[model samples]
Target: MGPSTIPAAVDAAAERFGDTEAVVDGEVRLTYRDLRTRVRQVAAAFAAAGLKTGDRVAICAPNTWHWVVAALGASYAGGILVPLNTRFTAAEMQDVISRSDAAALVVATDFLGRNRLAELEELGGVPEFVLTIEDWAFTDEVDAAPVRADDISDILFTSGTTGRSKGAMSAHRQALAVAAAWADCGAVVTGDRYLVINPFFHSFGYKAGILVCLLTGATLVPQAVFDVARTIELVEQERITILPGPPTIYQTLLAQPGCDTLRLAVTGAAPVPVTLAERMQKRFGTVLTAYGLTEAVVATMCRPDDDAETVSHTSGRATADFEVKIADTGEILLRGPNVMIGYLDDAAATAEAIDADGWLHTGDVGVLDERGYLTITDRLKDMYVSGGFNVYPAEVEQALARLDGVTESAVIGIPDDRMGEVGKAFVVSTRLLSTEDVIEHCRVLLANFKVPRQVEFRAALPRNASGKVLKVVLRKESP
Candidate 1:
C-alpha cells in the first residue's frame, strides 16, 4: 500500500525495519523503532502545546537528530513544517517566521558559537513560545493525525536573491514522491550509510537526504557542518556509503588527505564539470548528476549505469513520474506530482510559477540531447545579451573552470559602453592570476561576446548555505 503522508511513511518504515539503525549524530544513535517512538513523543508535546492541524511550526537549526525528529513530529501532529536556514540573519529568520505565521518555533540555542535563540529573542517579533532542541523529551503516546496525500506538508522558503523570500508550499504526496524518486534514481538502499552534509533547511537535504534515508531504510549520518577534516574522518570511521553535495564538496573531499573512497557520489546545486565528474567517478565507485529546484525536488538525475560522459555533462533524464520539456525560449518546464502546491500566501507569484496547463515554469534554461539527457545552461534571469549575442554565464563559467589554478568562478553581466552588456568573471584561484591571463584563457574557449571583459580574483566566491554561488551578490558588487 502506498504511504498517505510523511508520518505514515516513517511509521511503515519503522515497522518493517525495527532494529535497523536509522539516525546517527555525533554520539547519539537511534534505531527505526526508537526514531518512531521519539517522533510520537515530540508530536504529543506539540499537540499539548496547543498546536493544531495545519498550524505552521518553524524550525531554525542545523542538521541534527532533533531537526529530523521535529520535522517528522510536526507532520505527525498535523502541523506543517517550515525549516528556516540557520545561516539566515536574525531579521531574515524573523521575517520567515512572521510570513509563515508559525505558531511555534524550534530553534537551536547556540550553533557555531552564535546564540541564535538569543538573537531571535533580541530581535523580537518571534513567536511567543520558543523551544530549544535540548528541551525536547519523550512524552506519552499520541496518535498520528489523519492527513491526506494532497495536504500541505511543508513550506520551504526560497533563497530570495532578488526580493523577499517566498515560501514554496509542498504537499505530503509531493514530498514522499520526490524522496522515492531520488531513492530509485540514486539507488539508495537499506544499510547504506548516508552522510547528510547538506543542511536540513534545503529541499535536497530534507527530502532527498533525510526523507530518502527513512524510506529506503538507509542509515543517516547527520553532519551539522561541512568541515573537510570531520567529514573525512566520518567517511572512514562510519564506512559511509552515500555522500551527496554540490560540486565543491567532491572537490574538497578529493583534496583532503586520507579521505575514504565513497561508494556513491551525488552532486548538484551548481554546474558539474566533465573533468570533475570523471575524477569523482574514478575516485568514488559511482558518481551521479542531478537537477532540481525548490518547486520540485530531484526532477532529473543521472543513473548509476550512465557512463561518465553522460553523468558529467548532463543532468540525466527526467525522473520517473515527471515530465520535462524545453520551451521554445529554452526555459526548462516541468510537470509532475512532485511539483509544489503553490507559493504560500502569494497568489500572483503562484500563478506565475505554475500555469493552467499544470507545468511549473522553471526559470532555468536547458537543452535535451538525442539521448534525452538534459544540460542546464543558465538561469533565465542570468542570461544577458552582449552586442546582440546572447551569453549564458554558466557556459562561460564552465570554460573558466577548465582553467588551471582556478578553484571556482562566477560570471555576471555588467554594463558595457560599447556592447549592451559584457561578462564579468569573479574567480577564486589557487595562484595569483592577471585579468589578461584569464581573458586570454577564456578567449581560447568562449566566443568573443561570451568571454569575460573583466576578471576579478577573490579568495572565495560568496555562497549561500547550500553552496550555490551568489551571482546576485556578485552583480551588486560589480563596478
Candidate 2:
C-alpha cells in the first residue's frame, strides 16, 4: 500500500529509496534521505515562525528545488499550502492571500528579473511571517507534527468558466490518491527521470509532477522557465525518460531537436491531430492522453497499450476509481476517492456542484464510447446555437489547428442577424492572413453552422495562468 499522508510518503521514500537520488536541480542533487532531512528542517523552521495547525501558508514562486521543499515543508509542519500563480499581478496575489487568509507568505525574491516580494509589499500585501523560499530552513529541535490522512493538505484555486478563481480544498489522502492514480496511468516507476514543465501553482505540476515522483521513486528535475533550448539541454544532460504537458508543448517541441530520447509523453486538452499523435509516438516509446480538472486531478487516462489514434481522439477511460457517467444533459459527472472536499467555505456553490448522490457535476460536456473511453466535447457554457443547431467551438478550433500557419485559436459566439448566434474566431498565426483565409479553410473541414462567421488575427491570445484561453475576456471584447 502507498503512504497515507504526504509527510508519511516523504518518510517512506527516505526508508524505501534512501540512497536513490530524489531531486536534480542543477548541481544540487539530493537523495531521498537528504530530502527527508531537509523537509524536517524546513518544517521546524515553519514551526519556529509560529505556524499553527490548519493555518494557511501561501507560496509564490516558480518551479524549483525551493518550491518543492517549501510546499512539502509547509505540509510537514501541519500547515495548509496555498500556491499562488506566478503570472498573477500584485493585486491578484494580494486578493488570493487575503481570501485564503494566509498567515505566512513564502515567495521568491526575484523571478523574470523583477523583485516579486517588493511588488507585493508595494501593493500592501505584507503577511505576518514572510520568508524567501530559497532560505527556508531551521535547525531548532522540534517534533514533526502528525498529520492524519483526513487532514487538509492544500487549497488549490481553479478559475473555471466563471473567470473568478475558487479555492478547492483537498485532503492528504485525496491528493495522494489522485497523484497515485496518475502515476499508475503513466507507468511511472523507480529509476525513471521526469522533467516537470508544468507550473507548480497548478495541480498538474504540484500533485501529478511532484507527488508522482515522490511516490514512484523517480528523480524530479524542475525547470524554472520553459525555454525550448534549455529544456532540450536538460533532457539530454539528465537523460529524462518522461515528459508531459499540454498539446501546445508537444506541437512546439515537434519543431525542435533533441526530444527523441523521451520514453513517455502525456498530454491533454484534446482534439489532438492524429498527425501530431503519430509524430509523438515515433519520438516517445509511449504517449498517453488524460482528462482532469482542479476538482479531480486525474479522472480518466489512456493506457500504455492504447494506440496513437486512441490517444489522439479520446482522453481514455476512468482510472482513478472515478465513476464516470453522462447525465441526461450530457454533462460529465465524477465520483471517486480523489474528489476534493469542496470549494473552500462556499456551501451554496458546493451544494450546486456536488449533488446528494455523491457525484460532482462537472460543467464539461463529453461522450463515452462503447469501450468506456471518453471524448470531451466542450464546456456547457461555451456551446452556442447557430441556425437552430448546436456548435462546439473545440471542434472548430481543432479544424483551425490543422490549417497551415494557424498556430492557436479561440472561438466565441457573436450576435448574428440571421442565425441569432454564430461563431467568431480569434486566431494567432505564424504568417499574414485575411478573414477569407480562415473562413475558406474552415468551410472545407466543418459544416456551415460550425464554421466561424468572422475571424480576427492577433499577435497572441489572452490566457489564464493555467494556460486556458480566457474566452470570457474574448466575449467582452468589441467585435
Candidate 3:
C-alpha cells in the first residue's frame, strides 16, 4: 500500500511527535498533539454544521493557524478543499466560488486591513453558514468520514494568466505524492522549522508548504506577508531551517543586512539568476530550484548536493516517481502520480491540457540535457517570431536582469511594422535608467533580433499572487 492520505499522515505524525511544536504564528504556538486535537474539533464542527462528503468548502484567508485548521477540517469531513486567493478581488472570488459550487465558506473577518467577510457579503452568493476562526466550536460527538485515496482533495485555481482561471482538481493520492516528492527532494526532516511565506492559495504553499511539513513532522511558521525586516527577525528568532519563495524573496534577503542562518532555501515560479543562486548558497546551507505548475504541485527540483551552476541554470531532473519528456516542439510533458485528476467542471479544457496517453502537456518550452537537467526556455505562448527569428521573452528578461541596477524586468512581444513583431521590455530599477541604457545593455548580450526594440520603466512589474510576472497584463498595458 502507498502512503496514507493527508489527514492520516497528520494523524500519524501527531502520534509520533506528540508534545513537539507543530505550528507557530505571531503569538500562537501549537504542539502536534494540540494541532491534531484542534483539527479534529474543527472537523467535528464542520460536520455538526451539516457539511457532507464530496461537498466543496472554500477558504479565503491569509497564512495563519486558522487557515491550516480549516483546510484539514474540511478534508477530514470528506469535503473537497477549495483555497481562494486572498489577493483576489470580490468579482474574482465570486466567480470561483460560484463555479466550484462551494457549500460553505470559512474566511477571516479581517486580514491585511481588508474585511473578507464584508467582501463576500457584498458579492452576496455566500453559502448559508459562514464561520470565522474565532467562532469555530469544538465538539467530540462528530466522527470524520473515511477518505479514499482517489477522492478529490483540493481544487486549486490557476493564476488566470491566459484567461478565466481553471480549478485544477487534485486527488488525495496526488497530494500525498507531491508531499513525499517535496520532502525527498528538499530534504525536509522532523524537527526542522519551515517558514511558509508563500500564500496558502498557491500549490507551492499549501501542498509543498503545509503538507510537506505535516508529512515530515517539521514545525510550520506561517508568514502572512513578505516583509523583509520582519522575515529576517523571524529567521533569527525561530531558527528557520526551510525557507522557500520566488527568486525575488532571496534577492531581497540577500540585499538585507544581518539576514543569514537559513539552512535550506527553495526558489521557483521564475527564472533564478546565477548570481542569486551563488549568493544563497554562500549564505544558506543548501539551495534548490524547483519547477511545477498548478496542475502538478512539484514536478522537478534540484537536489541539495547540486552545484551552484546546475542549481541556477536548470530546474534539475524530474522527481523520482515522475516521467518528464521534452516534446519535439520543445514543449515539456510530464506523466506521474502527482498529475492532477483534471480541471474542475471543464472536461474540454482538461482534455486539452492532458493527452489520452496521460501526458500533461505543459505549455512551457524546455530542453533536457544529457544529464537529465531540464532548462526552461520560455512559455510557448510567450514566444514570438521577429523577422523569422524566434524570440523568447524569458531569455530577454534574463539578459535584462543581468544589467546593473535592474531589480526586476519583464519582456513581451509587440507589433512592429518592419519585423512583424518585436520584443518590448519593462524594467524596475533602483537607480535612474533610460531606455537607451537598457537597449545598450541588451546590445552586448542579446542578438539584434532578440534585443528589445522599446523599453518602459516602471516602479514594479505587475505580478500574480504566485510571483509570476503577468505578461498578459503587461501586453495589454504596452502600446
Each prediction's Cα lDDT score? 0.84, 0.84, 0.83
Runs of candidate 3 exceeding 4 Å displacement? 137-141, 159-162, 255-260, 382-479
- Against the hidden reference, what TM-scores do the models get? 0.80, 0.80, 0.80
Query: Model 1 shows how many backbone clashes?
Result: 0
State in Å the error of residue 146, model 3. Answer: 0.7
Model 3, range 260-309, lDDT digits (tens) per residue?
65789987655567877888899887999878878887888899899889
lDDT of 1 by residue, 188-285 (tens): 88889999987898888899998898899999999998776788889988889999876766787888665564789987655567888888877787
lDDT of 1 at 454: 88
Model 1, residue 37: distance off in Å is 0.9
The Cα RMSD in angstroms, rounded to one decimal, for candidate 1 relative to the true structure is 10.6
lDDT of 1 at 159: 41
Candidate 2 residue-wise lDDT, 1-479, digit = tens: 88989989988998999898899999989999888888888888889889998999999999998888889888889999999887666766887899899999989988887677898899885788998965655665455588899999999976534435578999999999989998888889999999998888889899999999999999999999877678778888998999886566677777877766688988764356788898888878788988887888888999988888899889999988999999999999999888889998788777887899889988889999999999987666786756434466777788799899999999898866445578999999998899999999887655466789889899999989999999989988946
Instruction: Give the clashing residue pairs of candidate 1, or none.
Output: none
